[model samples]
Target: MEQTIQKRLPVGGDSWVTVDVYGEPDTPGLVVVPGVMSDAHTWRHVAGSVDAWPSVVVVNRRGRAPSGALTNSYSLRTEIEDLGVVLDEFDSARTLFGWSYGGLITLLAANERPIPQVIAYEPVMRPFGRHALPDLKVAEGTADWDRCVEIVNRQISGFSAAHVDGLRADPHSWATLRRLSGPLYAELSALNAEPPPDLMAQQAEQADLIIGQRNRGTAPYGTSFDHVRQHVVHAEVHELPGQGHLAHIQAPAELGHLLNNLAAI
Candidate 1:
């Protein structure tokens, strides 16, 4: 449970902010990359469970909490560079676990560095079929902070209004989200304009992809496996039944077990 925060020296003139190392220093290094609008704290439960590991780095992407300065360029290349800065700080090739948008970042980084191992959970594939460009625009245009609150409230409409209020009242979660780069919404909006087929192909050549069977964002949830099976040669895929996008949060024990075993491999 030892906690420390340190600011990374500037990478390419941009400071990369991150949290301190967690767990034993001699254990295998494990890096957790959080999703868009999320920070290192989102991995608290997962990191705590794996504290037996020699080292763990929970990264806060640029423009996110514990980090500073939003880059106008929200391209995957920029994200990959950010990851490179973090990887440079580590002594050994490490296992990376990324969720949602963070999964995309992980994929790009693995493609660039050939890291020993990677575990990505339900990454958002660009050009999400039915949820295309126009839909993204609408979602973006309506995503003002106040509107975001409304959307969350409506999505959780079944809950009593008071309960929804309580959820929003949770300062930590909201604080973490507030640090998200405003351009992220725009970047997401531009998804349909350009599908990441190139990036997908790159990912297929690197890192193992972990998919949740019930995840609705990606086609088949298992489709990429078939495409990547031959190309990656050593990549592994795991499917968790009855699970969705938030599987890491909903099934931390199972996810942790999977990652722990992968680290051994």
Candidate 2:
């Protein structure tokens, strides 16, 4: 097994963030912000495959395990500040990679501070149709992880019944997804509650938006891709053949290759 370097930084008096450091530390590398239900532990495989940078700094954002809990005051700003902390401290993290919700944060963070290079994969930039958060919240409140997982997979993720069943059949995957559901409720609720962020002020010099070919034309994700192409200057969209939203997990090497190419520019 490859080694992972871990660092925990206190964000505020109450909140904390942990980062998994992979690759060489001799130089600044790409900083990765993960999705709604993932942190360093879950992102390990994908982070490992990305060798285009000197290091891979994956942020374990709030609401996820190994990081602080979602405080009553947690909001989008909290997520940005946590990411900003990593960016401010890590001078090597001049480029950023964001997945799903993390992609949204990457764009938002670029707005606050100009990033030299930014890449986002299927960011839920605009709140899509109903996530049934009320139901998901109730399930979470009662510790009904299974129900919570089902709702998120079917509703938030747009997974088919068969897909959900397959996930449930895999004990290991299901267990991780269930654990992640605890934080999913709060994060999705925050995404749904906030009005669409102002993309006009985003300041990335180079930006790339990636969408899975299988995920194209999907309601929420489709519009999100369009939104980025429409709003972000120099934003280019790339579709991965034979893939879906989970490409980072399903095809990390391929995704890493694509990112490396994007960075080569």
Candidate 3:
């Protein structure tokens, strides 16, 4: 294994963001985009699990404490540009793997600025049925970070009470979930209020859609794929057994296998 190095790139507004680079510079470029409440560290395992590990760039989106400060001008466009900057840092074909909210970002960014390829896991679509979107108003009204974290874990992620309790018991785990409540809320707000740009053609001809077999989040992914199928010439859907929405974190080895295989295409 090679030592991972940190790199920074300047986006608009004079704000600098960061990425953790791994593998050799000559290999194919793989950029990992994390979902809400996550940073570059969240993808550490997946990046490490890659076979012979290619050049991987794990990005820390805005509001992640390790990368940069959350600015007042935050929006989906800014986030898209942030990922684009990281891709520009590398000099090879950029293959993107995004999970959950990051999946949404990947699809949206590909539409605006087509990348070599994109693999999305459960991109956010208007939930399954009638469940309301995570209420930004509720998050705004509540000052208690713990409570806010609970709401998202349960209502949005569909985690059980026991899972929430276990998360709370671990100080590090609880802090990871609670630390970015503001950014998570902001992301939810954008999801509710805005729709991403539409795809014109098959921007990603060889895209892969990986989801968990038992994950309830699969429905939204299906909906998302249905909408984008016409614009995607070759989209294959695969499922990871015994995993859920956070499969990338829960089953890094298997997820990494799938991702690495996609990169080989």
Highest lDDT scorer: 2
What ranking of all candidate models by TM-score puts the best one first?
2, 3, 1
> Tens digit of lDDT per residue, candidate 3, span 44-96?
88888876346887888877866676577777778888887877777574687
Give all TM-scores, in the order shown. Answer: 0.73, 0.93, 0.87
lDDT per residue as tens, model 1, 1-265: 3544454535544555665567654456877887654667666667666643577777877666457655655566666677878777774636877876677667657766666677777655453322333443455576655444433333311235685566568886554444353445544443224545444325333366677777534443344334433444456777776775556677766776767766765
The lDDT per prediction is: 0.59, 0.79, 0.71
User: What would you estimate as the lDDT of candidate 1?
Assistant: 0.59
Error of 2 at 101 (Å): 0.6
- Candidate 2 stretches with Cα past 4 Å from truth are 1-4
Instruction: Mark the 10 consecutive residues where model 1 has the least summed lDDT.
Output: 150-159
Candidate 1: clashing pairs of residues: 24-54, 27-54
Give the CA lDDT, 0 to 100, for residue 108 in model 1.
59
